[model samples]
Target: MAHWDPRGQVAPHVRRQVASLAAAVDELVVVSTADLDDDGAAFLGRHGRLLRRTNYGYDFFSYKTGLEASRPEDFDEVVVCNDTYVPLVGYGEVFEAMAGRPADFWGLTASQRVHPHVQSFFVAFRPWLVGSQAFRGFWGRMSPVSDRASVIAEYEVGLSRTLTDGGFRFASYYTETDADRALAQRRVAWWTLHRLPPPRRRREWEFLKARSKDPWNPAIALADVALAPSPPRPAGARLPYLKIDTLRYDPYGLGAERLLRLAERRRPEELAGVREYLAATAPLSAARPDTDLRPTPVGVRPLRRLVEYGRAA
Candidate 1:
């Protein structure tokens, strides 16, 4: 997976994720957006090929860079992902589910809100799609820009349109169905009531409820449910769905908490790594003026510690 961090170093959770991916795939290459420190370099170097580049393009550019360096001809399939979400559980199950799918490219989940396209957080491209002119031309025509909106509009949204228009079939692990969408809405409501503080809870509930009727992007809510600790379920819910878009909205750091829990349960040895990471990064996150001002929740002690550290700093 192509990885990027604004801090110019990979987080411990990301390192663990890379190790997991390396175990599943035959070849793994990490294209970092910035120069790695000795530790980052050493960690990534041991697992796979590491390509460091100037932080010019976002994940899209990082993907392109990794593709060019690896030469798509050398591999049958290429998976492009970032360090945005923690694959708490079922990392291998996701790939295993997609193994025999007959699609040019596919992602873990598809979104239809902004446009009909697979969310780029975790996408896999087969050789047929990778070798196509549409894929090559998309990157060839790409111009580096630091603007987030431009990247989303031109690359994230536009790339899907380009490939689909070029007759490349698209598929996803989970397609939004009416039943699941309703489940997602209910999940959002339950989370708002149980998770958020009383003062902010009402406002968030009303806003989410209204949006649930005609969600601009249901994937966000779907992800909230899929990654939630104990997701509420109807009578019989069997299918597993996954989406990992961490950058969009995670004001409470619940994403990190879930990831920490996953590590503690499945991979307890990694807890120290995740704890150290949160202790260091959470303070940086809280220090921003735009950060949520609400007090940290009761159970997320690591985040609370970080808040204290930030206050002292």
Candidate 2:
């Protein structure tokens, strides 16, 4: 697993999730921004490997930084996730599914259910699939600079086209919203705008309201169910269906103490600096941020404590 963070401090929830993942897997690596400074460096050094870089914009920057810092050949399999999505199960089921296929790269394309949070915009795949020339061709056609969003757009379009051309079909649930959570909310909003409380006024108002807003709000599209192509493919370039619920767990924690311990063993001074920064930024803590060291308590600290941590160290 590889993690990238722009901030000096990692969120508490993210820390726990990461910890759970590391415990499940054998090799864990982290790539951070050097801008995190000594304290941030110390924390990462203790918990996992740290690779520092400058913060670029979202989309492209986050991906580029992670890609540039990753040693893909180091592990047999790798998983990528953001701070928001936590793993609720282990990799056992996923691994078994991959048994028949090559392990060059695997991406989780299915979810247990429709998530109501962020929309699941793009399908998952091995980075290389979307990183290929076919994808670049798509990107070249879409965006000139190839930043984050554009890359994502190009990846989606290109991957779909490529997979389809290769005889593989892309599948999605017709009834699902973005990440699965929006479906419910969309239905509620749609009903409120159009439904009449009284039988006397069963006018075209509700339908009209839906028509007016549906075009503008993408979530409204979830009301319609779009099923995947029926019948699994028998030959090359086929999309396979894996039951979403088969996943065992999804973690969302990062263990700070374990991380600290790792750092102390690898780089003592760096670990000290990290603890010092955390202390300095901590509310009512002895350490204070000085001219050189500015502790920024990022995770669970209070606002005043965070401000002081930033001011102290």
Give the best candidate by TM-score: 1
What's model 2's lDDT at 122?
Answer: 20
lDDT of 2 by residue, 165-253 (tens): 64443333222234334443333333333233322343665654454333211212221111123222222222222111111110101
Please give, for residues 1-313, the per-residue lDDT of candidate 1 as tens digits: 7776645677866877898888988888888875577888888899999888887778888888888887786677888887766554455767777778788898776767567887777788898888889989998999887777777788888888999999988888765557556655444443343344544677876875564344334444444344334433321231233223333234233343453354356445434465665555554442433224355446644433322101210
Work out the TM-score per prediction: 0.70, 0.42
> lDDT for each of the candidates?
0.63, 0.36
Pairs that collide in candidate 1 are none
Candidate 2 local Cα displacement, residue 254, angstroms: 28
Question: What is the total number of backbone clashes in candidate 1?
Answer: 0
- Candidate 2: where are CA atoms >4 Å away? 1-7, 37-39, 71-75, 90-313
Residue 179 Cα positional deviation in candidate 2, in Å, after optimal superposition: 15
RMSD of each: 8.0, 15.9
RMSD (CA, Å), candidate 1 to true, equals 8.0
